[model samples]
Target: MKKLYSHSSFFIFCMLALLLFQSCYKLRGHYGGEQSFEATQRPVQPTDVALPKGYKMEAVATGLTYPTGVTFDDAGNVYVVEAGYSYGEIWTTPRLLKIEPNGQTTQVAAGEKNGPWLGVAYHDGAFFVAEGGTIEGGRILRITPDGEMTRLVENLPSFGDHHTNGPAVGNDGYIYFGQGTATNSGVVGPDNYDYGWLSRKPEFHDIPCEDIVLAGQNFESDNPLTPDSKDKATTGAFLPFGQASQAGQIIKGRIPCSGAVFRIPATGGEMELVAWGFRNPFGLAFSPEGRLFVTDNAYDTRGSRPGYGNGDWLWAVNSGTWYGWPDYSGGDALNTDDYQTNKEDPKFILAKHPAKPPRPVATLGVHSSSNGFSFSSSPAFGYEGQAFIAQFGDMAPEVGRIYGPVGYKVVRVDVKTGVITDFAVNKGKTNGPASQIGGGGIERPIDTEFDPSGQALYVVDFGIMPMTEKGPAPRQATGVLWKITSEGGN
Candidate 1:
């Protein structure tokens, strides 16, 4: 086994080198898009990855292209979705696949240009998905087992840095999802160029679910829509490029708003707003007690607003409550030096608080990309009712600088006390990805789920997506799907 592992590693190394050489020769040093690399895949050594005793891990599927979420149907048939798009604007046909127990996979459905399909949930014999919709507007779709698809909602405001995400079905028979803001803070600016959407949809900006009175704060930056290299313009929250809102200006809010949570009938109908004021509410799951919990990505130290020194927030959501965005973090006001980065001092964009924002249950790492998660309900898995979140790790320099490697593992968070502890991480003296630490246990675990019986946990690994000065360089066919079954863990 050892000899076989070494031989496989050597082969991957050679292949990567050749691919890099070819890309450089063809692109003449362009780093974004037009370049494809393979993620180095070694055998999944259960012992090499640190997990609780009595729990064993196995790589059930490999060579997936940017997989985002994993789920299982009523009959215990496992399914996973390929995002079809990555941070660097690498777009392909998004797909849903069924994985057999032995790891063989078959395509179930294919999506259109509206991609980076963030997630899928199986409820009532149909698969519901949230399309990122970078090229077109975001949409919610339901797919039958035979591959017929229908649009439940369309023209959702997703032509921004973030897009439509989630569809976590609830006990109330509703499908809930998140719509992310177009800009980092409230204002859209040049920093959004990294997302590869601002240039395509210059008029696209965030829309509030309820009318908001602006503070009249306008951000000035190079207008991306204009051909002039230095044509500057001022932008404000809820307005397009070169548009500004005056003090106390009421921007009319509407349903299907950006930076909010929305729910629709399982059978498809009018979209209803659940809550608003999240910057990028990425992951949504329900606790055993029937409460919706969300993992929201914190404001980055980029963009025109550029707030600093705050980690991600995990909240037990309250219906119709405004969890502060563009103004607060972890229940603290952003209009203070605590959030001021070297480049910008953040200020509240709204004239008044919608209401005192509820504090997050727990805080995850900065730029950790604390995405898709699930609750462990099985008595055998331990930590029953606790969340198992996949920390996709940080995109440093591009997102911001980190003290050390922040999150590249799975963690369990206690809902009551807001305490977090490592459940699964790469085995190393120092924590990092396998590519950085010469290990192959795990890389960028994007989502987590348990089987219908709750006896096994499945993890989706969206493979190597390295950040460069140019932007994110996401590789293809480098993802992995892992399953962890427990005999009994206490």
Candidate 2:
């Protein structure tokens, strides 16, 4: 066992430690928070990551910052989006780069100096991007081969922990993407405001706001409410949405904007809502069968409105269907351990909701923060037709550090039964007992892309932070590109 540090001080130490070792799976002990452990120094080489018996993994490039989206052009060049902003620092424009077979990386476009970009895709000599967390709000922009940029959508409510993500092109000549919620669990309270960068705005800012769903009927304090607690139960109703306004007052079925999925036709027009009820949907992809699938980031039990997350999920997305949020987790009725109950009963919200959202096809590990995903099409990889998702892992455990280091690797899901199986693992520094949780060498994988010939799979590693850190380090020039293939064959 190692020493433990208080969460407050540990966050500060991690922020300042640039060359910190990766400890993605080390468990935190329940003590008085007097002792803390640090990872021993080790070089992060291609060999640090592990693959199954017949597979091999290696680094293609390194030294990028906070890379997220990955895609390939017709010319065999790899394009990646480096999210420019550090969590708590000044906004820096993210970059789109073109990488060649020789490992040379060239900048394609720096969308904006102060805004961050999360998702990207290549289509007909152009690159589409999802620019998030800006004064202008989340929007999808298109970049020409020569680097000219044009905004496709704008004024999206972009704040809180998640942002607008994805821009994959569908076979029907439509561009699909995801829009995340503005507040955690549909409430902008003090916990969100404390993050400082979060704008504390309501999630739904568009039409169809007329009959949104609500969780609790009235505001009740799990802890003492303060002026900073901007929850609708504390502050007057949020603009253009909240039906009632009053501190500790009761209101009928709450109306809130949950996370959603949207699509824009290739011919170009308005962005249409395809599905709703996600918390923080981070990744989207279509299977070889032409079915759409998505990876959603679930809720946290430490927020202002605390509740146990059933787990993150991979859903076989359906148009015009509800997937359950605020009132549900992982398709089951949401746990109401901390809110005020109404006559309709807090427990039955899931049963009574008219839309009756469908459950996930597969349940990911709790707090795994599942991100990008893609379907295996090439017979060379052996798992053709299976879907692969990047479990980016969780940071800042809720309460007593319960679910730290649950993700951090790639997983393969059975399309037929929705069963999840580990495809990659990182045994960390010592290969200690905790290493079974998959951390250390692999770090945080953000997106998975397969080569045109299907002989190779590309993975974007978003670097590694100490599992104990509250969030990602402001800036670490450690992003890497990993290629995975069969060792004996392929």
Candidate 3:
């Protein structure tokens, strides 16, 4: 016999249906947006691809910290760098480790908090590491195979949100690294309007304000000097202003940072600028043909007005070229309107000035945060000359206060044809369900590298984000290392 449901029970059923419908709508909207593109399907369990047939994958290691960079030595030993928690703040652990083929791990170097160490490369029998800093900025550490370490370079401008990271050994034998700007979009003063010491308001007089102290201004602001005025500007000589007055221009820049790629001689010398105007280049690599390529994180517009989906990019880098940061992203040309308000336009006399034409080989998902990448030189991987890139998930919710999460897996790209296909999936029951969560998964894999045999690939999993009122402690173990190998077949 059929029974009538209670009023409360019927209401609850209706509410659940409405919630499910709303969720589907949101997912559809997200995938149907301008950033939508064809992505490779992921498998629930690790699956192998058809690679001529005999090659296989084996888990060499597991349970690692936030491993961001990996490389191999001539002796077949593997080296990995771990940035333990603290990240951008003043309390992260920076470590360099060596992993043997037998799964043995050894710590080579360690630093204090906020030391976001990333990017390691083996060259000329020595290992170089990129140590990211906050107040003191980033530095390149040189280490011998015997575990001896020394600071090769220091005092990089890392106070900005994005610091210097990612070091690569170029075919030219020079060590290249990236140094990011301190401010977002080149604001000349504090972002806030509060009259407190941290505000970005201009000074009442022209007596060398905040901008002069932190980042010196090449010229005076709107106010000028008169022969006999109460607050006259000093000519030729610079003078200090009150601490409160100086706060306005502390974060200013003559021309907002285009971001830069620099090279230091293998034998040690001053770092020379290679390319400029990149937003945050997290990955750099040279193809088998010796061409330079860079992976850049796109700009976020949620904090500012009239936001645009500038889009992340994969650029074929050339010396003296500009990739357009703070002004442009993707392949769009730079325009006057893109500049930050209240700032002067950069001088455009140089040949590379006014933004050089950019031609990206591939367009990563918007806000995907693509990091380390390596060319699949091993024929065992099946795709000879193909490139593998790691997506560090998205961080918009933490920084930009927006949500545009699409990529959470490794992508294989055909550099010549601009074609991208999903290469590997990090899905499992331990992470979350297989069902789509707003068209994306939750595993935040940050870096990828092929094993010495080239039959298997290693990926670093930087666990879940901490949600408690008090975040995870410094050096907390919340990271994992996963190995992906071919199970066999097309």
Q: Model 3 over residues 258-342: C-alpha lDDT tens digits?
A: 2677778766877777877776777887777888788887764432111244556888888877665544556554444453233
Best candidate per lDDT, number?
1
Candidate 1: segments with Cα more than 4 A from true spot: 1-43
lDDT of 1 at 22: 63
> Can you rank all candidates by lDDT, best first?
1, 2, 3
Clashing pairs in 2: 3-35, 3-36, 4-35, 4-36, 93-113, 214-254, 428-440
Compared with the true structure, what per-residue lDDT tens digits does model 2 show for residues 226-295? 3454444442222223333333333243222337888886556877888887877788888888888888
Q: Write down the worst ten-residue block by lDDT for model 1.
A: 25-34
Q: CA lDDT of 197 in candidate 2?
A: 41
C-alpha RMSD (angstroms) for model 2:
8.8
Residue-by-residue lDDT tens digits, candidate 1, 80-160: 999988887778889999998788889999998889799999999999999988888888999999999999988988888
TM-score attained by model 1: 0.91
- TM-score of each predicted structure versus truth: 0.91, 0.80, 0.70
**Candidate order (TM-score):** 1, 2, 3
lDDT for model 3: 0.56
Badly placed stretches (over 4 Å) of model 2 are: 1-26, 29-42, 198-210, 213-216, 220-258, 336-352, 398-400, 428-440, 467-471
